[model samples]
Target chain A: MKLLAITSCPNGIAHTYMAAESLRKAAEALGVEIKVETQGSIGVENEFTPEEIEQADGIIIAADKAVDKSRFTGKKLIVTGVQDGIHKAPELIKRFESGDVDAYQGDGKSINEVKQERKQKQNPFYRHLMNGVSYMIPFVAVGGLLIALSLAIGGHPTDSGLQIPKDSVWKQIMDVGSAGFTFMVPILAGFIAMSIADRPGLAPGMIGGYIAANGSFYGSEAGAGFLGGILAGFVAGYIAKWIKTWKVPSVIQPIMPILVIPLLASILVASLFIFIVGAPIASLMDWLTAFLNGMQGASSIILALILGAMISFDMGGPVNKVAFLFGASMIGQGNVHIMGAIAAAIAVPPLGMGLATLLNKRKYEKAEQEAGKAALAMGLVGITEGAIPFAAKDPLRVIPSIMAGSMVASTIAMLGNVGNNVPHGGPIVAVLGAISHPLMYFIGIIAGVIVTALVVNLFKKNVA
Target chain B: MKLTELMDKSLVDIDLNGSSKNEVLDEMIEKLDQSGALKSKRKFRKTIEKREKEGSTGIGFKVAIPHGKSKAVTSPKVAFGLSRTGVDWNSVDGEPARLVFMIAVPEESAGNEHLKILQMLSIKLMDEQFRTELLQVQTVDEAYELLDQIG
Candidate 1:
C-alpha cells in the first residue's frame, strides 16, 4: 500500500515543519508505507512519482494555505488544515486503515489555484478591506508600543492628560510612534486596494483612506476612522478593477494602466468619498464618539459589555476588528478613555487562556500548555490573536469566558478614568506610558484575566 | 539486529519498472505478496495507506521507508529494493528515491518492531561507506549480505 501527504503553513515557517515532523514520527510508529512532500517557504520537497500514486491508498493534505491537488486524482484524499494534521495524525491514520477515505479527484488545481479561484470569486470590496487590515496590524503594533513605552517612562500627569516634556527623548519616541500611527489608515487602505486592483488601486485607496481618516477632506473633525479605510479600500479596488476591465483600443491599452486607469479611479474614488461615503460615515462616527463620551455611570457598563463582546466574539475576526476600529477612532478624537477600555479588553483573552493552561495543565495537551506561555506573553504585548487557536478549537466556552473577562476589565477601566493615547490594548501598553492611570489599568487587566482563566477552567473539560 | 532476521529474502526486488509513487507502491506490495510476506493484498494496502495518511515515511537522502502495521503482515520484516533510475517516493528533500525500504510489522508488536527497524536503518544509513557499498551491489544477495554485515 502506498500513500501521499503534503504539509504546509501560512508563513511556510515553523508550524509547517513542526506538523510535518509530528506526522512523520506518527506514521513511522504506525508502521505504514507513506510518502510525504513538504511545501515549505523554500519550495516543494520530495515530489511523488506517477508509479507511487497508482499503488497508493490515500492522500493527506495538511496545510494552512492551499496546496495543489491535481496529482491525487482517484486516490483517497483527506483534506484538513495544518493543526488538524498535528493533533489528529493518529486518528486520521486509523480512519484510513478503516478504508473510509474517498478518492480525491484532481481538478488540475493546487491549493494556490483554489485560492486564486476563491479570490476571483470574492467581493472586491471585502478583498481590499482584508488586504488593508493585514498590512495595518504591524504598524499599529509598532506605533502603539513605542508610544506606550514613551508615556510610561517620560509622562507626567497634566490637566490635558499624560504629558511628556517636549525636550525629552521619551517625547521624541512618542512623536515617532505617532508618525507611524498616522500612516496606519492610509497604509491599510492602500494595501487593500493594491491586493484588489494591483498597483493602480494603491494611490486611490490611500487617498480614500486619508480622506476617511481625516474628516477635513469631507468637512468633519472626526474622520470616518478605520471604517472609512474599509470603504476606501473597497471603492478603490472595484473602481480600479472596473477601469481595467473596460474595452479600449488595442493601441491605447499600453497607456491605460499607467495614465487612464489610475487617474480615472483615483478621481472617481476620491469624489465618491468626498460626496457620498464620507459625510454619513463621519456623522455616524460622531454619534458613536458622542455616545462613548457621554457614557459616565451605568452607560459605561453597557459600553464595556458591548466592547468586550466585540473583542472576544471572533478572537480577532470581524467583530474584533470593529471594536478595535472604534477604539482607534476614539484615539484620533483625543478621547483616550475608549482606547483604555479597549486595552483592558484586549489583554483578557490571552491572559485568561494562559492562566487556564497554567492552572489546569490536565485540561490541555502538551502543545497547548506550551502555546499558553506564548499567548500570555503576547497578551502582555497587546496581541489579541494569541487566543485565536484556543478559540477556534472551542469557541462556545472560550468566547464567553474571554468576553466576560474583557467586559469586567473594560468597565473597570472606564470607571477608573483610565485613558490611553494610543489605539492598542494590553497591560504592556498601559505600563509603557500610552495609558493614564497605569496602575489601575494594570489592576483591571489582571482582574479580568483572572476571571477569564477561572471561567474557562470551570467550563473546559480535561481532554488530555 | 541480523539483517536476515529483519529482511525476508524473497521480498527483495532487483528491478523496478514503475516510476511513479503509486506504481512503485503497487510493485513493492506485489513483490511482498509474491514472497508470501503479505497475507491479504487489500488489507496490506489499507494498512500502508493508513500509515501514509498519517504521514510520509520519506526521510531525506535518496532513501524512502514505507512501512505499516497490519494483520496482513506475517512477520516484522524489511524489504530492500533498488531503483537506479530514481523512483519518486516523495522524499523529504524532494529527491527521487533510489533505495526503497518497505517495512511490515504485526499490529500487536507494531511500536517496538517499528522503532527497532527504524533505529537500525537510520544508524546504517548514516554511514557513507555502508550506503556506497549497498548502492554498488547489483544483486539481491549482495545487498542482503551488506545489510546482514551492517546489522
Candidate 2:
C-alpha cells in the first residue's frame, strides 16, 4: 500500500529529519512504498504532489507543531506527536495493516492544532511572500540569460540604449526574453495569492498584476511595478480567502471558488489598486529614479554597499531576493549600472571563501577543501549559495568576511561605471560581454575575492 | 570474497565464554590464527588493538565489528563469535556487544576485498530479522548457512 507522511517538530530540525529517516527505514524494512515530507528549519522538503496524495492508501502526520490537515481530508490518516514517528515508525505503519485507523473528516480541534494556530500566526506573510519569490526566480534566470545572450551577439550601442535590429533572429530571442520578463510580475502575484487562498486567489491576483503593470490603467506611467504587484497579491489573496468563509447555500458553494470568488476578488483588487495604491506607487518609482539618477560619488557608494550587504547577508534569503528583484526591475527601466554593482557583489562570497580554502589549507578539513573546488565553480556561474557550507559551519568568521568582500566589490563596480543589463552577476556575465567596463568588473571581482580570502584566513587559526 | 568462504567451522565460535572485550578479541584471533589465516598473530593482534583505540568497533545493537588490515596478515578472513554474557566495548549506545564479527586482511588486500566483506556484512547486519536468526542458530554449520545467504 502506498503511504504518505509528514514529519515535523517544534524546533524544525533534528527531530523532524530523524522522524523522516526513521519512517523511511521502517517502510523499507516492511517492503512498503512511502513518501515522506519534512518540514524543518529549511522549510518544507520532499513535499507530496496532488497525485501522490490522491493515490495514497493512508497518511501519517507525526508532528508536535500544527500542520495544515485541510488537504488530507477523505484520506485514512493518523495524527500523532513526532516522537511516535522516530521510535514507533514501524508500529505507526502497521496501524494501517490492522485496519484500525479511520478516514479523516474535515474539521477537528486538538492540542496540536491549538499550538499550530499560535505558531501559524507568526510568519504567514513570510510564507506567502516566499511562495511568490520562489515562483518568480526561474522567470528571472531564463529571461535574464536569454537577454544577456541576445545583447552580446546582436546588440549595438545606439541613442535609444542597447538595441537589436528589427526582424533579426537575435531580436526574436530578445523578444522571447521580454515576453518571459512580462510574466514575472503577474506570476509572482498569482502564486502569492495561490499560497494564501489556493486556486481561487489566482485570477484576481493576475488581473490585479496586469493592471499594476500597465501605466494607462492608473493615469500614470511606470504603473506601480513589482511593489504594486506584491500589494495586489496580498490584498486579492486575503479578499478571496475571506470570501471562501461566507457560508453560502449548498448549490452556490460548488461554484463559489470558480465563479463568485474570482469575479468579486478581481473587482475588489482592481478598484483598490487603481483608486488607492497605484498612482502613489508610480510617483514614488519616478521620484526614486530621479533620486538615483542624481546620485554621484559617495551617495551611490552607500547605495551599492547596502545592496551588496543585502545580497550576501542571507545568501538567497528574503533580504537577498529583495535586492535581486530591485536590480532586475532596474534593468527594464534602463538603469543597468545598479544591477552591475549587484552582479559584482553576488559572486564575491563563494569565490572569496573558495580562495580562502586554497590560500590557507591548514585551516580547513580535507572535505572542506573538496567543497571549496565546487564552491569556486558555483561562484563562476554566479550562485551565491556556494558559500553556505562555510557560513553554516562558522557564521561568525564567514559572514563578516563575505559581506566585506561583496561591499567592496559593489562599491568598485559602481565607481567604475560598470553596467550589467542582465540580472545575474559573476565572471560568467562579464565573460559573455553582458557587463560594461569588463576590465574594471574583472578587477573588482578579483579584489573582492582577495579581500575575503585574506579576512577569513586571518580570522581562522592555523591547524593544530 | 564471500564472508562464508572466508569463515568456516574452525573460524566460528558459537558460544564464547569471555566476558571482557580483550578476552573476546583474543579468543577470536586465536581461532583464526590456528586456521593459518594470519602469518603473525602478535602483529595482527596489535593492528586490531590499534584500530580499536581509534574508536571502539562496537556499533551498538549488541553487535561489534573489530577489523584490521595490516602487513601481519597473509589472507583476508572473518571470525564470528557469540557471547551469551555480553562484553563491554565502549559502544556509542553504551550497550555491551553480544555478537562480534572480527575481520583480518593483509595490507595488500585492504583496499578492495576488505571493504567488500564489510559492505556485504553490514547490509545483512542492518536487518534485525537476520541478526535474530543468526543469534538463534544451534551450531557452526547453521551460522555458516545463514552467512552464505548474505550475498
Candidate 3:
C-alpha cells in the first residue's frame, strides 16, 4: 500500500523532522511505500507531487500547527498532532491496512467556528430585527437627548408637560431633533431590508415605512408606529429578494439590482400599506395607546411587573427590546410614566451584578471582580449588557436575582408617578434632568440594586 | 556557515549529570551561558520553560530538543548534551530522554545560512544510524567532529 504523510510544528524546529523520520521508518518496516513531507524552519521539504498524492491509498497529517489539507481532497486521510506522529506512527499506518479509513473532502473548521456558523445560519429573523434596532438607536439617542436639552433650557412646565417657545433657538434645536425623529422609522425599515436583501431593498423599505407612519394615506388620525415599520421592512425585503430569483434576459440583467428590483418593491410595498395594511395597523396603534392611557392602579402595576421581568429576562435581547420599544413609543404619545418605569428597570441588572461582587468578593473570581468595576460604570450610564458576563457564567442564579430586583424598581417608579421624557434609562437620565421625581427614581434604583446583590449572594457558594 | 560555527567543542557535553528535566535544562543553559551566547540566562530560561509548558520538546525515541527564541540571547547558538542515565522529559513515547539539544536564537537573528544548518541537524538526528553513532561518542571532540560533517 502507498501512503503519504505530512508533519509540522509551530516553531518548525525539531518535532516536524522527528515525526517525519518516525513515520518513514515505521512504513518501511511494515513493507509499505511512503513519502514523507516535513515543514520545518527552512520550509517545506520532500513535498509530494500531484501524481504521488494520486497514487497514494491514504494520507496522514500530523501537525502541531495548521497545514493546508486542500490538495489531499478525495484521499483517505488521518489527521493528528505531531506528538502522535512520533509515538503512534505504527498504529496510524496500520489504519489504512485495516480498511476503515474514509476519503477526506478537504473542508475542516475548528469546533468553535462551526458552532458560530450554525448560530448565524439558523436565526436570520432575529439577526434582521437586531440589525434594524442597532441602526435605529443612534437616531433615538440624539433626538431624545436634544429634545430633553431644549425642554431643560428653554421651557416651563404647563398642565400638558414641558414645551419650548416656537420662535427660540432651543425650538430650532428641538426641531432639528424632531427632524431626526422623522427619519427613525424609515431608517429602521430601510436597514432591516438592506440586511435581508442587500442594497437594492433600501429605497423600497424606507418608502414603505414612511407610508406606514403617515395616517393620511389610509384616512386615520394616529399613525402606525414601530410595529408598522417592522412589517413594512419584512414585506419590502422579501419582495425585493424574491424578485432577484426570477430569471431575466441578458439585456435586462444589468439594471436588475440598481433599478428594477427597488422600483417594483417600492410600488408593491407602498400600495399594500396604503390600500390594505395601513388602516388596521394605525387602528392597532390607537387601541394600544388608549389601553395604556386608561390603565388604573392595578393594571399599571401589572404592566410594570411585566416590563420589569422582560427587561431583565434576556438583558437586551428580543424580550427586552419589546418592553423598551413599548415604553419609547409612549413618549411620542404624551405618556412618559411608562418609560420612567422602564428606565428604572433597565439600570437594575448591571447595577445589581456590580453590587453583588462588592457585597461578597469570594463568590466571584478575580476577573469577575474587575468586570464588576466596569459593570458599575456601565450601570450608571444604563447599559443592560454590562451584566452579561455574570449572567453568562451563572444564568439561573444571576438572571432570577436581577429580575426580582428590576420588578421592585419598576413597581416603585410606577407608584411614585415618576416621569421620563427621553427614550433612555438609568441614573444618567435623572442627572440630565429628563426625569420627573428624580429622588424616587434614585430610591428605586438603589433598592433594586441592593435586592439583587443580596439575593444573588444568598444563592452562590463561596469560591474555593 | 554551518551548525559547527554555532556549536563548538565547549558546547558539547558527552557526560551529563542531570537526572531530571529541570536539572538537564540548567546544565544545558550553563554550557550555552559559558559559551557567551546568552546575555541573561534567567530570561532565556523563562522563555524555554514557557515553550516547554505549551508542549514538551521531547520528540520521542529517547531524544529531546529544548529551544528558545528570545531577546536575552546574544547570538544564535546550539548546545548538545548526552545523559547516560536518561531524564524524564514527558516524552510521547513514555521513555526518558538521553540525547538533548538546546538551541538558542536571538529574537531578531534572521540569518538563513545557520538556520538551514540547524534544520539539517534536526533532520539528521532523526536517523537511527546517526543517533547510534552519537551515543558511541566518548568525548566532546568526537561529537563535535561528527556534527561538523552536516554543514
Candidate 4:
C-alpha cells in the first residue's frame, strides 16, 4: 500500500526533519509502505509522484506551515500539524489503512490557503512585530559590516583609542554605515504596522518609531531605541486592527481604511509614545549609557562578561541585540575597545559551530554540514545571527559553548588592548584596519572560535 | 468487483496458529492448494517473494495483504486468516501483522481484477462495523456471509 506524507514547520529547520524522521520510522514499524517528503528552509526534499499518488492508500500532511494538498484530492487523507505526524504517525497510518479517512476533496485551497487564513487571523500586533524584525535584519547587517570595514581600513592608534582619519575615504564609508543605522528604528516600526494594518499602518508606525528614537520630542537625551520601535509597532498595529474591525457605513468603509484608521491609529500611537512610554524608556536608555560609560577596570570586565554572555546566548535574539546596541553606542562615543570585544564575541558562535562541523563531519547531518559552510562565511563578516538556526535547535550544547568562547575572547581583547574603531567583530574587520592590535584581535577571535568548537563538539552527542 | 467474487467460504481458514511469517504464508498456501484455487505452490510463492523483494506489501496497521497473480491459481480468490500472535511481514510500520488477507488472481486478469478486489477491500476495511464483525467470526461460513454482504 503506497502512502505519501508532507512534513514542515515554522522555522523549516529541526522540527521539519524531526517530524519527517518520526513519520518514516513509524511507517516502517507499522508494516506500511510509505514515502515522505520534507519542506524545509533549504526547500523541498524527496518529492512525491503522480503515479505513486494514484496507487496510494492515503496521504498524510504534518505541517505547521503551508503544504499544497490539492493533489491528494479523491484520496483518503489525514491532515494534521507536524507534531502530530511525529508523535502519532502510526495511529494516523492505522486510520488510513482501516479506511476511516474521508476522500480528500480538492477545494482549490491548498496548504498555502490554510496558512494564509491562519496568518490573517493572528493578532495584528504580532504581524507587525515580525514585519519590523524581517526588514530590520538586512539594515543591521549592512550597517555593522560597513562600520567594521571602515575601521579596518582608515582607523589609526590615537590617545582617544582607535580613530578613523577625518578626511579619509574610510571615514566616509563609516558615515554611510551610521546612515544605515539611523533608519533601523523607523523601518522596523513602519514595516511592523504595515504587516498588521497593511498600507495605512506604515505612516503611523514609522512616525511613532522615529519620535521614539529621537529624544528631543520626548524631552530626554537618550532615545528609546529599538525597544521603543517595537512598542510603537504594536501600538500602531492594534490601533489599526481595532479600527479595521469597527462597524462603519458602506459609504465610509473604504474611506475608513484610507483615512480614518491611519489618522486615528497614528495619532494614538504617536501620542502614547510622546506622553507615556517615551520618557521612561529614554531615561532608562540614558541610565544604561551612563552606567556603561562610568564602568572601569573590574567593573568594566564584569560588564564585558555580561555583554559577552548576552551576545552569544541567543545568537542575534533580543538579548544579543541589546549587547550589540551597547557596543554600537560606544563606537559613537569614540571608545572602540568595548566595541572591539563585542565584535570578537559576536563572531564566536557561528565560527565555532562551523569549525565544529568541519572538524567532525560525522557528528552533523548533511544539511547541518551545509549550514556550517554558510555560518563560516557569515562569521567572517561578523554576522553572529548566522548561527541562530543551530543554536535554536540544540541550544543546550551550542549556547553554553558559544558563551564560554565569547567571554574568553572578550576578556582577551580587553587585556591585550585590542580596540575596535567600528562596532563589529570578525577577522575581516580587523584585516580592513578597524581594530587596534589586529594581531592580538585575530588571536582572540581564533582562540574563541577554537574553544567554542571544541566545547560544542565535546558536548554534542552524535545524532545518527 | 463484488466481495463475494473475491472471497470464498472454502478459502477462509478458521484455525491458524502460525507465529512466523514463513509459517503463516505456508499455511495459507496449503489452504489455497487444498481448495484447488492455486495450481503451482512453488510458482505462487515465488511471485509473492518477488513482489516483496520489490517492496513490502504490508500496508501497516497490523494488516498484511500478501497478494500475487500467477498461473498457479485456478481462479481469482482471496483467503482470510487471523494470527493472534502476529507474523512479521516486513510491513511499512514494522509492526507484526495480525490479520492476513492473501489474494491469488489469475495472471490474465491480474491487472484489473486484482485492483478491483483491492479497491473493494480498501473501502470496506474503513468500516469499523465490517472489520469488528470479521475479526469476531469463528467459522468460515460466517466470514463468507460478511463478504457476501459487502456486495
DockQ of each: 0.01, 0.01, 0.17, 0.01
What is candidate 2's CAPRI-style docking category based on DockQ? incorrect
In candidate 1, stretches whose alpha carbon ends up further than 4 angstroms from where it belongs are A1-130, A289-300, A303-405, A412-443, A447-464, B1-151
Local distance difference test, each candidate: 0.72, 0.77, 0.80, 0.72
In angstroms, give how far residue B102 of model 2 lies from its true place.
Answer: 71
lDDT of 1 by residue, B1-151 (tens): 4656766678777677778767888888887777767789789988888766665655446767677767787755677888878876665567788778777765433113334434456546645577778778889888878877744
- In model 3, what is chain B's TM-score? 0.96
Q: Report the number of the highest-TM-score candidate.
A: 4
Candidate 1 matches the true fold with a TM-score of: 0.43
Over the true interface, candidate 4 deviates by an RMSD, in Å, of 22.6
Off by over 4 Å in 3: A1-110, A130-134, A219-223, A249-251, A289-410, A414-438, A445-464, B1-151
CAPRI-style docking class of model 1 based on DockQ: incorrect
For model 2, chain A alone compared with the true chain A gives a TM-score of: 0.50
True contacts kept of 1: 0.00
TM-score of each: 0.43, 0.40, 0.41, 0.44
CA error at residue A245 for candidate 4, angstroms: 1.9
> What shift in Å separates residue A202 of candidate 1 from its native position after superposition?
1.9
Q: What ranking emerges by lDDT with the best candidate at the front?
A: 3, 2, 4, 1
Candidate 3 scores an fnat of 0.48
Could you give candidate 1's per-residue lDDT for residues A276-314 as a string of tens digits? Answer: 966775566556555555653447668877887778765
Please identify model 2 stretches exceeding 4 Å from their true place: A1-123, A223-227, A249-251, A289-407, A414-438, A445-464, B1-151
Candidate 3 backbone collisions, by pair: none
Tell me the alpha-carbon RMSD of every candidate.
20.7, 24.4, 20.1, 20.3
